[model samples]
Target: MNAVKIIAASPQEALEQVQAQVGPDAVILNVRKLPIDGMKKLWAKPQVEVLAAAPEQEPGEQESLRQLAVKVQQLEGELHARGVVPTETVPSPDAKLPPKVMQMIRAAQGDKLEEALLPAVQVLEQIGLLPSHARWLSAQSRNFLGATKPRNLPEEMELLREVLSEYWHQLARRLEKPGNPVRVLVGTPGSGKTTVLAKWATQETFLRQRPSRIWRLDADRPNTAEFLSLHGELLQVPVERVWDPDEQPPEDTLRLVDFPGVPADQP
Candidate 1:
């Protein structure tokens, strides 16, 4: 099978492009960071090169996964050789980071014990997280790691996993309030409102075995994202184009609505 070359800014975008072009059954063959030239290397954000192809004409699921795993090992080896993935021989406290996280290793370790959390806080702030929120998370991590004194980098990383696991385990429970059957997903534009709706739909429809439908309504702008419609078709969930805000939804069946994101600056 002929493979298609895709260059995308992130893995999610690359996956979306592959799904759109080669169908959801498509298998990824290889992935790598694209090269930057000249002075562009100083300021340019990195792009990823993905090699993928349709599977019906090629290998089945098991074969596809094996090929994908081999490709991943090769990619990881290349990164490790280039000093991107740290090995045991490196032996630097600052170079090692949390599993699968490469950028969180930048903060220099200082003499103060609290400075150990500096790297995580900086990473959060870089992604538009508020300083206050970062501090709160850091404090929470400290609480879990309190029994152990003078935590090292590895211990701090383990603390992050523990905190994340605790919070996400709570979030994985049933999604509903006592009196609410209709739930609407709302957020700033590009904040994954539709994606969250799809997840909720999966739980409501497939896992719960409950009757559910999806409503795609405009929030401030037109809800142009095709993801909801595509996902609705896949799950066999009835999808409606729009609904009048003045009308109350039927109480018997669960209704998940997809809303366009409002600007964060707007009221």
Candidate 2:
């Protein structure tokens, strides 16, 4: 099931709206008052921000979701072990998916599809997507699943898988095209910064068919990961090591850098 964010004048109103749109099976995760800023705070009625999700339909999905939950817990433990707390994850400016992806986004923003988009949105949030990204993905998925409707739970799950595959393809095509010439990955320990850099670098050199270079540099502390260099050798891409503050990426060549194990407070 997907998660959705609902805003209303009161908690009761917000809960009622979530139940109405997402059905009574909706599970409320968080509810907080939204503060208005400046002079508007004086006149505005307090708004409630409620994060809720719909119940899953199938036993198989329940198991899969349980596995995902376990993994999330593991990652949380890892984060705490490193003294880091990440509040938000922002997507890249060119993060949009293609193959008619923008059209679906337009449809989702309309008030008419609000109800239809809630289920996808709710499920996405429960799985860790920010509400905005969840809404966008749900909107795209809703439009992607149009015309031919799913007849049953199994059919609906199958459609979801198909939609996911199509989105991945669009993402690969996005990487294959000439855009975002420089890519940088940053995060605390065990946050997949290195893994993310590897995937994107792979996409650039192999999938996108472009020349690329990997830079391993230290920011505040000494960088100590050999993963990128080994992977670069395997991928037949040039790998540069050591801390270089005055350096610039080679003219017109894609640059992938992995700066891991650095504390968030540092540069």
Candidate 3:
């Protein structure tokens, strides 16, 4: 699958360009208003940018396309670093990969890398990484080992920890800061939406010393309302069941709305 960004005078024009260039199977990823340029800001209207991605291809072709896309991205980065414009068209997915990239792909597919990294993979798996996540971590560990050899098991484990720590730090940094005055949690049944909301409320009230109000819109779940109320009482915060859609929370307080869990199939 391919992705591209297009800018036009309006959203409709941008979408028309996407459909023309990316084909009818392309899906719109995002649309945003682009900033008006210097002189254009005085008289011209702002442009709109649309990001779109092509539909998935067949399974056998999909893997090849993914690898090609990654190589293309790497090539683009190299070109950008050297202040050179990257070529417009990348090699087709069916085209043969370069020797070095082919070797890397082969090594990733082979059992030798997996065997060498099994201990680290096991360690990560034991620490709550899902099977897929463990495999991904193992692959990254293997790549790291290829570039720099570790002398012992302890060193290998340290490298694994470093990789995990870097990823954890990145994930934490990417988490949205609590900027919204009114936050809502909505998810499917048994999705732990209530638990997450309660935890956020706890952090706001006790950790940040900020007053918070909890509203339960899930009247169907009386038990959840009671659970939130119990915690509210302990936190000395007001918990209300939102019977009316237009009901507003108290002023100068962080408001958290707990929504009813909808069925996945329904939505």
Residue lDDT tens for model 1, 16-41: 68768876655555667689999998
lDDT of each: 0.64, 0.64, 0.64
Which stretches of model 1 miss by more than 4 angstroms? 1-129, 145-150, 167-176, 187-209, 226-236, 244-252, 262-267
- Scored against the true structure, residue 155 in model 1 reaches a CA lDDT of 40
Q: Which pairs, if any, clash in model 2? A: 1-123, 2-122, 2-123, 3-121, 3-122, 3-123, 4-122
Find the 10 residues in a row with the least total lDDT in model 1: 85-94
| Candidate with the greatest TM-score versus the true structure | 1
- lDDT (Cα, 0-100) at 252 in candidate 1: 66
**What tens digits encode model 3's per-residue C-alpha lDDT throughout 26-88?**
555555667776898889887777777776675675575566556545544554576753122
Each candidate structure's TM-score, on Cα atoms with residue i matched to residue i, is: 0.43, 0.37, 0.38
Model 3 pairs whose backbones collide: none
Candidate 1: clashing pairs of residues: none
**For model 2, how does the per-residue alpha-carbon lDDT over 3-77 read when each residue is reduced to its tens digit?**
799998865577568758877555555556788999997788888787777656766866875665565456556
